[model samples]
Target: MADSQWVDWTKTTQSKNYRGSGSFATFMIVGPVCFFLGILFASFPYDFPLLWTSDPVAPSYYDQLETHLRFVHQSPPLIARLLNIIMTVGFLGFFIKLFRPSEANVLFDGASLVLYVIGAGVYIANIVKGMRAVSAGVWHTEDFKGIAHDGPLTGEIVLGREDSLRVLSASNTILALVLVGVLVLQAGQWYAERREAEDNKKADQADKEAAERKASASAGSGGSGKKRQ
Candidate 1:
C-alpha cells in the first residue's frame, strides 16, 4: 500500500510538471510569431511603396528605406532582449529536468532542448548579426570607406541595404516557424505520456479489483467447509 501511494504521487507530480512545461513552450512559440507579425506591420508603410518602385536607389526611395532600417535596428533589440531572457530561463529549466530522476520523458525533453538550442543558434547567428550589421551602417561601409558619413544614401549602397533587410526578415520568419515546430513536438509528447499514464492507472485498478474478488471467493469457500465439518 505504501509503495502504491508513492507511485501515485510520482505520477501525479510528473503529470503536473509535463503540463506546466507544455504551457511554457506554447508561450515561447507565441512570442516569436507575434514578433514577426509586428515587424511586418511596422515596415509595411515603407515596404509597400518600395516594392512597387522601379528605382529603389533613388534619394527619395532610399530615404524611406533608411527610415525603415532605422526602425528595425532600434525597435527589435528591445523585444529580442526580452525574448532572450525568457528563452534562457526555459533552457535552464529543461536542462535541469534532464538530470532529474522524476522525469520519465528523458528522450522527449532532450529532443526538445536540442531543437530549442538550434533555434537560439539561428537567432544569434543570422538575426542578431544581421541587426548589428544594419546598426553599424552596412549601407555606407563601401562608400564611406569604413568612416561614418551622414546624409542621403543612394545608388547600389541602398540596394545592398534593402537586400540585407529582406534576408533578415526572412531568417526571423523561419526561426519563428522552427520554434512553432518545437511547441508541436512538446504538445505531442505531453499527449502521449498522459495517455500512457491513464492506461497504467486503469491496469492497476483492474488488477486490484481482480485480487479482491479472488480473496472474497477464498473466504466464502473456507466458511462453507467449516460449516460442513
Candidate 2:
C-alpha cells in the first residue's frame, strides 16, 4: 500500500513539474527560431533602399569576369514584402512567449522579458521600415561604387530605413545576450530543484529504513515478552 502511494505521489510531482515547464519549452522552441530568423534577416544582402545605376566597379580596374558581375540583382518586390511581414510575425511570437510563466526566478524572468521585448520591438521596427521601403518601391539595392537613390523614396524614408536597420543590428545583439541569460537562469533553477528532490529522496529513504528497524525491534521485543510469560 505504501509503495503504491509512493508511486502515485511521484507521478503527481512529475505532472506538476511538467506543467510548470511549459514556458521553458516554449522558450526553447521559439527562441532559436527567432534567433535564426533575426540573423538571416540581418545577413540578407539587400535590406536597405538603394539603387544601382551602373556597374559595381570600374571595368578598367577589374578583370573581364569581375567587370560583368552586376551589383543590382532584381528580385520580386511582393515576395520581399511578404518575407518582411513574416519576420515581423516571428518577432511578435517571440515577444509573446517571453511573458509566459516559467520556472525561473521572478527577477530573472523579468529581466529576460525586458530584454526580449526591446529586441522584438527593434526587429519589428526594422521590418516595418523595410515594408515601407518596399511599398515605396525602392528597397532593392546592391553594392556599387556609384550607388544612387534611383528609387521612388524620399530622403527621410531612406534615412529612417537605414536608422532602423542599424538599431536592429544592436537589438539582435541584445536579444542573443538575453537568450543566454534566460538559459542560465532557468538551468540554475532546474539544478536547484533537482538537488532539492534528491535530498528529499535521501531523507525519505532514511526515514523508511529507520521505521523498518523500529518495527523489527518492536516485534522482537513482543516475542521475547511472550516467551517469558
User: Which run of 10 residues does model 1 get worst, by summed lDDT?
Assistant: 5-14
Clashing pairs in 1: none
Query: For residues 136-167, what per-residue lDDT tens digits would candidate 2 score against the true structure?
Result: 44423443223244355743335433343344
lDDT of each: 0.61, 0.47
Which tens-of-lDDT digit does each residue in 120-190 have in candidate 1? 78778777777676677766755644333345663323336656666666665566556666667667766
Model 1 vs. true fold: TM: 0.62
Runs off by more than 4 Å, candidate 2: 1-18, 22-114, 125-168
Q: Would you give me the overall lDDT of model 2?
A: 0.47
Error of 1 at 75 (Å): 4.5
TM-scores of the models, in the order given: 0.62, 0.46
